[model samples]
Target: MATSVSVAGFHKPLYSTTFHGGWGTSICGDNSTVLIKSVPEAVRVVKPVRFLPVMKNINEGKGLFAPVVVLARNIIGKKRFNQLRGKAIALHSQVITEFCKSIGADAKQRQGLIRLAKKNGERLGFLA
Candidate 1:
């Protein structure tokens, strides 16, 4: 897993005015106020958003493959199963990519492998 850190800052001036004899006097004379706010505290809020997907390991073979089997069983008839079977490998690889991403797999590498799986399925005529 990889952690990405970032920092940001914002600054604004606080101003005030004062009245003097026969005139409005800018007593502060545009005193420059400097606020050096450390951004380390911000990581707590942002870490979850960026790493939400990798919190738990997604066991692809056990978690996802079982559901595919259950769904394959529920199809109405042989014809439907046959049709679904033709698409099974490609669909399996797509789901695996999602599972990999959830379990901290590098996005670019995982996607490239998934594309290869899809292309293989297509070459084998499993996908038209």
Candidate 2:
């Protein structure tokens, strides 16, 4: 006989267990393969989980004063931080472009984000 177990957030039963008095129980979860295959390709892409705000701040001319900027300077040293800060727009564009690339975003999507960053930076009185 097969026994089913339900888990929260999953539409179907997660797995099944078969019982045999002498052998105890055998567990199997054939649905895992199905679940893995069901995931969308876009969901598999890798992207930065943090630092988006930092990118935005830098683009808005808050380079040296941004908390993340201060943290990064502390972590990477002032010399390297200054190098990136000297070319804020380039650094911002590069960071956003890299994020887009990591997430497998198409060229149009990448360009749109870069443009938005530039617009926001300009509106905030920052040069980009």
Clashing pairs in 1: none
What do the candidate models score in CA lDDT, each in turn?
A: 0.51, 0.61
**Candidate 2 weakest ten by summed lDDT:** 19-28
Off by over 4 Å in 2: 1-86
Clash pairs, candidate 2, are none
Best by TM-score: 2
- Give the local distance difference test score of model 1: 0.51
Question: Cα deviation in Å at residue 25, candidate 1?
Answer: 78
* Highest lDDT against the true fold, candidate: 2
